[model samples]
Target chain A: MFGRIFHLLVKEFLQMKRDKSARFRLLVPPVIQMLLFGYAATFEVFNVSTAILDLDRSQESRALTDAFVHSSRFRIAVPAASERDVRDAVERSDVQVGIVIPAGFAELLKKGRTSPVQALVDGTNSNTALIALGYVGQIAGSFGQDYARNLAERTGRALGRPMVSVGLEERYWYNPNLNSRWFFVPGVIGTLALITIVNLTAFAIVREREVGTLEQILVTPLRPVEFIIGKTLPFFLIGLLEVSIVAGFGMAWFHVPFRGNPLVLLLGTCLFLLAALAIGLLISTVCTTQQQAFSSNFFVLNPMFILSGFSFPIPSMPQALQWLTYADPLRYYLVIIRATFLKGVGLDALWPQMLALAAIALGLLTVAVLRFRKSLD
Target chain B: MAGAIVEATGLSKRFGAVMAVDGLSFAVQPGEIFGLVGPDGAGKTTTMRMLAGVMRSDDGSITVDGIDVRAHPEQAKRHVSYMPQRFGLYEDLTVEENIRFYADLFEVPRRLWEERAAAMLTASNMTPFRKRLAGQLSGGMKQKLGLTCSLVHTPRVLLLDEPTTGVDPLSRREFWQILYSLRGEGVAMVISTAYLDEAERCDRLALLHDGRMVHCDTPAGLKAKMPGAMIEVAAAEPRRVRDAVQKLPGVAGVLLIGIGAHIHVDDAGRRLPEIAAALSAAGIATTEIGEVAPSIEDLFVALLENERNAA
Candidate 1:
């Protein structure tokens, strides 16, 4: 059985090597996708155009406007002549956010009265809006605090306890810069490997069936288990190789940090790939045609990617979907990848996710083997 | 040589409402080419699959080299190599690679691999093209290579389903030569073919129709079982002669053979004058009328038509 599986592996690899197009497919697309998506699939919101309407035209309002212009997150638009001008700029998408300061805005701060500053924000593309709003809120709050301190000192009165005592200092651990690329590049490593390995493995058995080669092998003495292993081992190795190369490129080209142990990454990658390849084998077992397999891939991959918390945070998803995501191996893999890439987390911190991945891989492989045996029978 | 290497008794198979092979019984001896001859959907392929232990039979039993096919398909499969209608060879792999793949699957020892492979390749005239990709080969060469791959492990029994269906005449002949050589070496072979001419080459043949065996015998015996004599009638207008004579009494079946028509009739000595008279009255002048020995094609057609009429 070992000799037979070894022979099948050799044949599969030789065939892949001889086909020039297949060889190119093995190495090229994943690299291109890794680089392209690393740059493209980022979440950092920058250069957002903002329009300011300051009715007061005073030092305090101007200082707040200056802060918006100086920050990397927003580009300053022409100062609006009126509230109507702010509306026009926002309506035309000339500005994503409009800051409308009231007529007594500077006078109110001098009197230590609460000023209601109306900041109109576009809610489309919610993630960008959310981040931009946070930045806007911080600038406004700090401006108020600075004004309050200046007023207290200039009054020559004993500074009593202030009304607003709530102050927050939010610290982002690991990714202190909040670089979205750092989060995306590592996730892309798992994603690229999953797509390539699943796609290739899905076609392995189905292609043989379509070309009439699988039936020829069935009459031989080789068992189904041996065939499954022989067919999957090379692809399993290729999946891991893809992970190392893409992860390396991510680190070198994109400067995405790899702070975790290399061995943990390897272990997590293998477990994730084993589950992915097993899902592909499951698709192959049920599909009789290559077209059916290709269509089924979309069904499997789209849900897996969307629910994986790769780009979208799992915590924010609906409760039902969050529960559903727990069943997806990619969800656990993303946890391992993102944590290991940014947090420098070791196995002790990541054991639960890793264990979930191992369990999923085992279940998927067992189901695939059972389905394949049924297909043969 | 060896006693019956493959014995299938009272075999039956069904697909939904259709009975593909029903109540079929046959045995193949060592060193013999047993042909399962049938038309499309006649259950030749299905029966071959059951005998090879890849397909389950709805009823009855199949044994290959003394191993019950249903009970131990792997063990039964080890003793046989079944080349399905489309002989599956990896198009990208070289001919040599395709042959060695099967050898490895069968776990043929490295020491015996060269000797076993060389014999098949040389017999099939594929030795010179060993390096050629299977996709690049001509249809005939691919078929020959498919056979070589199937024989890599030196199986005792071979079940080939239409292995030579679409090959060129020369390749078909060469393929048969390889099978004949294997037969000489005490290999029992069960081959299925739609071509009646190829059926004549088998040591014994079982004619199947609608999942039931209508007749089973040696090629000559099948021909001899034709219930009546066959008369090859020719005239100026062949279609007119065929139309006129087909209506005559005692005529069982009429089929076109080349430009002439071969008519099956009961007691040709008695029906010969009546056929001549009928064609004469239709303004078709008969040039020849005589009893000819039935070929395998003629016997198959006549038997199938008889079954249709009885049904």
Candidate 2:
């Protein structure tokens, strides 16, 4: 059984090595995708173009506008001539945000009266608009607080005598720096590995079925256990290699920290890969055509990405949806990978996720083997 | 003659409402190329798969080299190599790599594997392209590679399911040559083919129709069992000739051959004058009329027609 499996692994490796296109597909695309999605595909909005309608034309309004320009979050495109320009700029996406200081903005501050500043935001891309709004609000609030303190000191009154005294001390646990890139890069590693490995293995068996080579393999003296092991092991290793490459890029280029033990990470990745390859094999057993395999893979991949807690937190999802996450090995793998690579957690902290991944891998492999045997029958 | 290399008794397989192979029974002797000749959907592949131990018979038993495949498939597999209609050859792997992979799977000793791989490659004429990936090879070359991969382990019995279905005429001939060469070495081969001409090359042929074995005998013996004389007629209009021939007093069946027609009769030579006279009366001129030998296809068609009419 071992010999047969080993032989299959060797064949898989040789096939991967000799086929230049498949080799490129197996080795190069993941690294390219990692860099493309890691650096270019980002959720953190920055360098947002803003249009300012400084109606007051006073030093205070200018200072506030200057603050918005200096901050990396917003880039001032042009001083709007009218409210119409501000609206048009935001409407056309020429600027993402528009700040309109009222006509009495400085006069109100001098006379000790409140001024309402209208900030028009483009909500077309909701996430970008939300982040830009947060930046705009922070800048305006800090400036107003400083202005109030100065005014109080000058007037012989204390601004600290307000009825509401609210303080917010924010601390980020796993990702202390709150680097969205760091969070996303690690998730990309797991996602890329899952997609590539599952697809490769799924196509491996389906291609045999398509080309009529599966019958030859089944008739061999090799047992079902041997055949499946042989089919899956090489792909498992390839998946590991891909994860390592993506992780290396994350660490080297993105400077994402690897907080977990290398051994634990490697072990976790191997288990996850086994589960993914088994799923691919199972898909292969079910699909008779390459098109069917590809379509079925998409069916598996979409749900995997959604439930794996890559884009959204799995725990925050509804209970019924969260239950579905248990079957998704990527869900456990993402936790293991993120906790290990970002938080620097050890086996003691990540053993449950690791164990869950192992169970998924074993269960999927068992089903895949049984299904493959039935397919032969 | 040295226990049957492959034996199946009362083997049956059903797909939905259709019976693919119902009560199939046959035995293949060692050192012979046994042919299963059938048309599309005749259950040849299902029977072959069961005998190869890759499929379970609905109700029956299969023993390959003394090991009951239904009961101990793994043990049965050890003695047989099945080359399915589409032989699985890893397209990404090279010819030599494919051979080595199968050899290792079968646990052939390293030294023996190298020798066998070299010999198999040479025999298949794939030695020059040993390093070329299977995907790069032509259709015929790929088929040869599939055959070589199956032969690498050197199993006692070889089960081939329509191994030359889409192969070119030259490659199909070469494939059979390799099969005959293997037979000379005392390997039993049960090969299924849609081509009756290829079936003629087998030492014995099992004619299957609608999932049941209609006849199993030497090629000559099966042809000898054809019940009527076949008369070829070249007429001015083939269709009218066929119509006139079919309506003739002594004609049993009229088959349209290329640019002519073959009329099956109880006594073709004796009735040729009458057939010619009938063709002339029907306003169709007869160019040629003579007794001709019936092909396996004709025999199969006749047998099927008989069964259909009876049903």
Candidate 3:
């Protein structure tokens, strides 16, 4: 059985080496997707276009405008002469954020009177809008704090220290600075492996059936179990290699840290790949053509990806979708990988996820084996 | 049957409402080339697949080299090599690579495959193209490669389903020569084909119609089973000759050939002169008229026509 599977591995590798499209597909897309997701598919909202309208034209208002311009989060895309201009920039989506300062804003501040500034944000993409609003809040609050400190110094009552409002001291652990690339690059590695490995294994078997090679192989002394092992083992190896390349690229290019035990990562990856390849095998068993296999892959992969918590948190999903995610191998894999990459946790902390992944892999592999028959019928 | 290397008894396979192979029974001895001669949809492929242990029969059983196929197909598969009509060759792999893959699949030892592959490729005239990709090979070379792969393990029983259906005449002849050479090594071969002329090359064949075995015998034996002598008559207007001769006594049927017709008569000695006279009487100038030995095609047509008329 080992010999047969080894020969099959050799054959599969040779085919992969000779077929230009397969070679390209196996090597190029992961790198491209790593770059795309690492840079583009990010949660960090940067360079948000802001339109500013300072009605007071005072030092206080100009200072606030300068703060918005100097901060990396907001780029002053338009200088508004009137509220109409700020509203137009916000409405046309030319600027994602708009700030309008009222008249006497600096006078009210000098007199220690209450002052208010109106901020407008486009909520079409509520996530980006919310993140941008948070940045705006931070800049405005710091500016107010500075003014309060100056007022205390002038009055000589609080000894040049600003009066404290409710204060927030925030520290982001694991990923300091909340670098979204560091968070996303690891997830990209998992998602890319899932998509590409599933497709490779599914299409490989379906191509055999389509080209009439599967029937030829069945008549040999090689058993169905042997054939299934032989067919899938190569892809399992490829999945590991692919994950390594993508993970290495993520680490080197995106600086996503891999702080966990190498063995733990290897175990998680093997379990995940087994589950993914088993899904591919199951799809191959049900489909008669490459088109059917491809569509079926899309049907399964989309839900798996959505429920995997690659981008969206599992708890944030609907109740039924959350339950559905329990069955997604990618969900467990994502947890294991993220915990491994970010928290540097080993099996003690990740055992439940590892167990869930192992169960899923075993269950899917069992079903796939049951479905695959050594007969054309 | 006792000495047969491959035996199938009362095999029946149904696809939906169609009985693709109904009550099909046959046995092939060692060193024999058994042909499943049929038209399209005649269950030749189904029967071949069943015998090769790659398909299950709805009824009956098959044995390869005394191993029960359905009960233990994998064990039976150890001794049988099946090459389907469309033998899947990995287009990206070279011819040598394909042979090695199958050799490995069958668990042929490295030394054994090296020797067997060298001989097989040389015999098939494919040695020069060993390193060429299978996708680059012509239709005939692809078929030859498929055959070589199928035979790499030197299987006890070889099943080929329409191996030469689309191959050129020369390649088809060459393929049969390879099969004949295999016969000397005591390999039981079951080959199916829609080409009737090729059926004559088999040692014996089972003639199938609508998934049932209508007749099973050697090619000459099948021709001998024809109820009457075949009288071949050539004329400019063969249809006119057929019209006149088919109406005469002892005439069973008329089958048109190129510019002639094979007239089936109960007694060719009596009907030959009468057919000639009738064509002359009808003003259809005859090129030739004589009793001719029936071919497997003639026998098949006569048998099918007889069954249709009987039905």
* Best-fitting candidate, scored by lDDT: 3
Per-residue CA lDDT of candidate 3, range A36-65, in tens? Answer: 888898788889999999999998899988
Q: lDDT scores for all predictions?
A: 0.86, 0.84, 0.88
Task: Evaluate chain B of model 1: give its TM-score.
Answer: 0.94
Candidate 3 CAPRI assessment class:
medium
* Residue A256 alpha-carbon offset, candidate 2, angstroms: 2.1
Root-mean-square deviation of each candidate, in angstroms?
3.4, 2.9, 4.0
Off by over 4 Å in 1: A50-66, A76-95, A98-120, A140-165, B233-248, B273-291
lDDT of 1 by residue, B1-311 (tens): 24888888899988889999999998899999999887899999889878877678889998888899889888887789998878999999889888888888888886787788787788777889988889999999998888888887889998899998789999999988888888999999988987888899999998988888898889888887779999998666777777887777899988887658899999989998888778777878767878898888899999898788889
User: Lowest summed lDDT over 10 consecutive residues: which window, candidate 1 chain A?
Assistant: A156-165
Q: Per-candidate DockQ versus the true complex?
A: 0.67, 0.73, 0.68
lDDT of 2 by residue, A153-239 (tens): 777664322224489999998778788888889999999999999899899889877886677677777776776777777787788
Model 1 achieves a DockQ score of 0.67
Better of 1 and 2 by lDDT: 1
iRMSD for every model: 1.3, 1.5, 1.1
Q: Which digits, one per residue and each the tens of the lDDT, describe model 3 over residues B75-123?
A: 8888898988878999989999999999888888899999999998898
